[model samples]
Target: MPANLPAEAKAKWLRVMEARTPQEKLEALKDFLSSVPKHKGTAKLRAQIRHKIAVLRREIEERKRKRGKRGPKFFIRKSGMAQAVLVGLTNSGKSTLLKYLTNANPSIAERPFETKLPIPGMLQYGDLSIQLVEAPALIEGASKGAMWGLQVLTLAKNADVIILVIDLSYDPLYQLKVIVSELSDAGILLSPKKFEVRVERRRGCGITILGLDPMECKKLGNLLNDLGISDVIVKVSGEASAEDVVNAILGYQHKPALVLATKYDVSRDNFNKLEGACRELRLKAYPFSPQIPRENLKRELCRAIMKALNLILVYVKTPGSTPIPVTLNEGSIVLDLIEKVLGNRILGEVKYVKVWSNRFKFNPQKLGLKSPLGDGDLVEIAI
Candidate 1:
């Protein structure tokens, strides 16, 4: 041991020693690599750490290939307006966040992998409730069924949102790499600058394209033909390239994701490192801490989730009462809200609605069923 090592380096080494899971240890090892002082005296120690990290990575990959079949224990039923899953390496404060955000009381411990199964919790934000499920720790090679990762990913595919719970107390950037790589391999993409391709198959009609050039459309059609698909209507949106077209044709969907940097108060330097890394990777990281008041954390999380999911809250009133809030997608119309709140019965009698949209430069206007609703719109139904 180096006698003149920095205090932060010593603390990271202690975290590595206290780590109880492979993924946690991997994160600690990375922290140690960054914290250690660079000098001739520590060259041998740095080399050893690098070698161990490489060896552990290989071992984790091997275990992934050797894992057996998974059964029904990993199922999660999503409730509320949207569902979000927390994915990260072990001991990333996922369980702690879960306890704070939802009604779930998962067994919290100082050890890694304390959560072996999927734990579901409900996070209520205003009139909207989101289902937040904490998945088992995801390690490298998780897409290949490493640590039953495929099972957890299966649940993620069904979720409307994916919230990555990163531990800023350690090497959150590296842990994020592991999580993103695994999710990508499983055909789950998380990008705020994401593109969407809509393919509508039409009988006996040649491929028609919208929002893309003719050449791009022809290329996409060829790709789809190779997959035995033909006669389709394809619409590309949001800066989609050739590669994005192919991915969509192959049943790929762009999923919205948010990053939550846990234990932000533990170390400012570590938090900064995480934020910079996420920015380079085109991800936005939100700060989270159990040490802070629970309400504050929840409000921040709700805002992030709403942004990721492209959702807005709509307040609807019967006539003489406080507006009842209902959550809906950003482009939702008045008819959609009526269907969600008042059901089909209201559709028969309601002709128009009076709305005050603070989002747009408009006064209280009477809108038809097809009129779009904005965030925080106060709506009144006229029978």
Candidate 2:
């Protein structure tokens, strides 16, 4: 509704003008949402368009349901020990990287945006199979809802970690800028924060807080009550500020991420610049090429992902079955592993857990649910 709209906005408006159906209009509207500048004057218009988008989406879904088919779904289920998404600009060697790293074949071509959908593959690292998915390119203005941009970001949000594939042959910094900007606008934080905050609504809880000070809890509770959210449990880990808490309440994901600079052999000089810049951004950047030995590449990639995610692998033993590996965050407890592998019902029945680890003094240590677990720990839940 702003008078001085940009050319991009006008182009998107043209799409709206040409839209003949509700579905077409929905897509056009989404396009314009990206086109329109974010400012106080356009807030009302953006809100109205968002409302229309929601209604149209529902209608589309309802029609699909009537026909017994699925609607516009761009979701990929997580597989392997952990899920990591590889995202970057067009022709950034994402498909090529996936081909070399994982056990799935994705079309690699010279054209832009050749890979339309998200492709999933499994990376066999020693005894573990880590799922690595290649996501569609996230272009500039993606957060405002560029062409399938929201869907691309949805793929990123669903992943446990992110690997940004950048082309070393080009100005890798610029590619990183575009991708990082889009991710930031999508509310994805790359760097690991010292603290994490989570809130869950429990109707009768009256705002219980864990791992936080009593005084701060009262302050937070008062704020939540002011916002008509009094039945939520607020959980905090490590140190967090007021802004961090507010960002958490508004919804954000602090993804574990790294940058993989492809075509390193072609642009060896650029790789140093890219790595230096990434270091300044607190992001680790690695050089990759097809000529590198596969086993060494696989090993290095496995180690990098494990370090980036701060993960510890726990091998769970089941009777008459092979031990299953489970990836848990550093400092995860036995109870956390129990619920993940055995489900919630079994947690209450767990008498004690038997753990065998090289770090422990004894061969097998009998521990409780709250006992901390370590990497390569063999666990048996005796319920």
Candidate 3:
């Protein structure tokens, strides 16, 4: 069941949604939490709201500390093909891995939590560049305002891929468990997703519902109405539970992740155990250590991230230019590539596309916009 918030709490939520800045949101969220009734039904909702408040407060205070003093950025912007964030317990070789992959040299100290802010480095694989970011180290309670835990989790939530760097010298499974639990509590899901919902507030799209019966939609609509959510499109999909729906309303994300077992040369037995556990848990794990060659590790890590993200590369040729690489989801068709290569306005103007791939023997195969593109395909568009 939903929170079934009272009118006062609902009004407070509206103000929270309307809030523009961190300080404004912090104040509004605090006020909203006060109005929420204390009960078993509202416990999870209150916890999520409190987490949001803590994150906002931290952001505000961080900005204040950085006021006019140019500091290393806390918020990292995305670049290159995709963003792959590195997260692990302190001193798990995240900084060393970043240093090996990219030119950005972060301090690689023996002490834990040496990397206070998010560090970014670029990994070049063939012709593609994937952005690799090392997040601040995580502690047990990082999700609930433990020394920049929420910030690190937020980074993971926004990233296209998550790299769980674990040390084989320690209990790899235990470290992995703590990191996954913290991420799960912060609404950043790494395991297989069982629920998905999208709620959008759009004008003229009045009370639209999908994937639910009329009565269920009506009940859900009434719940949203109580919270002043009108003219909204609520899309529900997958095997969702009541709690899943509530978490969706609270804004949760699913991420694709893999594990990199560091210091693997130290203990093969530990690595073997971790690998077996990863197989059972449906996660991919790789071995890493100082003994292993760094260059080969860089290439292997880059390709792994691409595959984990399920991304593909396609080449587009212009009239007077050479074919250039473009990235898209693995199963995207030619039209999807066209819309990206040429803007949506050009969709109607395309006459056809000529594609060349290893599957075809001829010089070029004539394909329509709907034609499926394979990896490393060269395409010429006619308009």
Candidate 4:
């Protein structure tokens, strides 16, 4: 018979997983195993926890051995763009969202966990293109590091922004709590006060939306107090027909957000219910039908996305080099890279090239010279 486990043991078990180093994790595991009373009720759980710890210890040893023989296990090269991750439960329209927003064509299925590997997509908003990465679904006990939960959490930690998608058809609040707990368990530390505001452009007008912004921090708490919302914010737009709203939010600066109600064609009342819920949460909700013709909606959404992101596309040319592709936001400096290459001492020696009438002229250099310049290239001015 297993013993009844105390609350302290469970808390200790959680803390053990939070250990940073392998040695610490081992120590935590040992402590937890020792602290847990062995009785009929808890014996089975203790065995399970013990098995997990043993597996973790073995994996750690293997990693250490490999590190001694080699260097690091994996190398992630940083691309020159801020990375945003789209996360949600399986079939929560994450893949669909990625497809509509970026060039990435991940498998969109009705099944769960369609995206096992991290899928990266380039989101072209106006002239700037941001990288959007979609991670796998997070399951229950994810906070406890169950079934690759730790891996997912690690990915989330590295992200500049985390876009958590949830199905409005289900309990949105419940889903939010699950994600928050998972993040907390993974040590991501998502504070409501730390939430930033994102401004999006919709229908040729700029719309400012509150995210986890400080101004809205209390709003979430208030909602919780009223039992109106759960731990997570659900946007009905994922199921809605308004792709523009979705694009606007994604391309929005400061990570602005709105709720999208999808599958409105199924039932009018469903859309209304979602809208009402959004109103209660003080969020904007739009009804959308996914079955609508693609051409009818894509352009508007793309435009909105581009506008919201404040993206700019610039062309660059370097001597004896193929045109390198680069996208930058408006008002960003191209001289930073040039300075790095030319060194600070020689900064004044190079002239800044100005773009006039959609044409850039090298200072004091004659125009109309036949040079192959492709789109999205950065050119340096050499006097």
CA error at residue 375 for candidate 3, angstroms: 1.6
Q: Number of clashes in every candidate structure?
A: 0, 0, 0, 40
> What local lDDT does model 2 show for residue 326?
86
For residues 1-383, what per-residue lDDT tens digits would candidate 4 score against the true structure? 32444656655655563577777877887887887776665666567557657656655755566467764222123343456666667776777777866788999998777777677887764444557677788887765657655556656766655666666666655665677566654445332121232322233221223334444445433422221112233232222222222223222112322333444455546556656654664434444456755544444443333333444455544444554445445455545434434556765665544222234444323222223332344564444
lDDT against true structure, model 4: 0.52
How would the candidate models be sorted by lDDT, starting from the highest? 3, 2, 1, 4
Inter-residue clash pairs, candidate 3? none
Predicted structure with the largest lDDT when compared to the true one? 3
Q: Where does model 3 exceed 4 Å of error?
A: 1-28, 37-52, 63-69, 104-109, 114-117, 148-151, 191-196, 200-234, 238-241, 276-282, 291-296, 319-321, 344-352, 361-363
Error of 4 at 364 (Å): 15
lDDT of 3 by residue, 275-322 (tens): 898887678899988777877887788777778777888899865579
The best candidate in terms of TM-score: 3
Query: What TM-score goes with each of the models?
Result: 0.71, 0.67, 0.77, 0.47
Model 4 ranges off by over 4 Å? 1-80, 101-105, 124-128, 189-337, 340-346, 352-382
Model 3 whole-model lDDT (C-alpha atoms): 0.80
**Residue-level error in angstroms, candidate 2, position 136:** 2.1
lDDT of 2: 0.79
Error of 3 at 214 (Å): 13
At residue 222, give the lDDT of candidate 1. 60
